[model samples]
Target: MSYEGSFRVWRGDDDAGGLVDYQVEVNDGEVVLDVIHRLQATQAPDLAVRWNCKAGKCGSCSAEVNGRPRLLCMTRMSTFSPDEVVTVTPLRTFPVLRDLVTDVSFNYEKAREIPAFEPPKGVAPGDYRMAQVDVGRSQEFRKCIECFLCQDVCHVIRDHEQNKPAFAGPRFFIRIAELDMHPLDTREGRAEAAQDEHGLGLCNITKCCTEVCPEGIKITDNGIIPMKERVVDRKYDPLVWLGSKIFRRQT
Candidate 1:
């Protein structure tokens, strides 16, 4: 069975825009993206939306639904009643290019800031080995689909545009965290990078990023918090500092 659903889709470019309401037919087992597709086909022929692999893997359909960061393709229409008015808007953290499509180049800039993974010097590609426990930690973080939903919800950059210069947000924290935790990655100074350079201190553990993650990655608790603790331990704890100094002197 299908019914009419009202959608308040923000329509315009970076300069200005507002919610343009559209009444569309909702179908069984359809998602928010489906409603948007209907809108493109019927009411608003000029409506522009970016989506791929409508199965929710591509993370291209990132948007704010009812004021929450979500993947439009993953959000089931059945979650809302037939009469409930759904609101879909471009990610507020970034400039909108057109209707429902935001210029997410900020995330690309942040991605470039993260240093690439560095394997141990002696470990060639064929000889690389990792314990199951270490592999487990990095594996969890590698699941991120680059949705930027985490980046969009992070208040450090969300509310304060100035923070963009410093903050890489939760998504890249996952990237850094994975590299830092990887057994094969012998690179040092990631803890410092996460704290001093990437604005880890700006995160007050709101867990907003974790809540919106489609991958169910424990971004705040597992990645950000652990990285924060590691940073603090390396920076403030006398034992780790002394150990590092002793190791350096011996070498």
Candidate 2:
């Protein structure tokens, strides 16, 4: 069935902005992004929406639909009644560049702060080996498309901008977790990075980030919790502390 509806899309740049309603016709199996493109073609020629692969794989086209973080390309128009108006707004966590476009530079800066992987030295390029079970742990986190939806929904950095400086959000926590779990990684700073002010401690584990993840990454359970466990082990485990000391003496 075909239905005509009005979409109230937030439109503007840094100086000023407001919601501009546009009328569009929707067909069965149509997604919100489909209707948005119609508006761009007919009503607003300059309407800016960032998107790469319309197919849900790109992780782009993220926005807030009726106040919830979601990927426009994945949200079906069928979910809402034709009589009801759908509101599309840019992600609330980042600075607005224009209609449906937000500056996500903050994420890049935080990423730069994370220390890169430092594998054990003297191992030949193909000599490093790891058990399948150990390698499997990080595979889930590797699914992230860098959509930043997890970053946008996270309250530690979303609602509390003040905490941005000290919080790495869920995305980078996954990175840190992946690196920390790597069998070949000789880096000893995982515990320190996780304990830092801008680390895992800031996360209240609200799970909002996980809900909006396009790749269905288990951000809170599989990633954040394991990293937290590592931090706890390093800071409080007497056995590990004593073992490390003895191992150091023997070396």
Highest TM-score, which number?
A: 1
User: lDDT score of model 1?
Assistant: 0.90
Q: After superposition, how far is residue 223 of candidate 2 from its true place, in Å?
A: 0.8
lDDT score, candidate 1, position 114: 92
lDDT of each: 0.90, 0.86
Which candidate tops lDDT?
1
Clashes of 2: 1
Work out the TM-score per prediction.
0.95, 0.93
In candidate 1, residue 193 scores what lDDT?
87
How well is each residue in 116-216 modelled by candidate 1, as lDDT tens digits?
98987877788887679768988998889988999999888889999999998999998999998888887889989899999888999999999999999
Evaluate model 2: give its lDDT: 0.86
Worst 10 residues of 1 by lDDT: 242-251
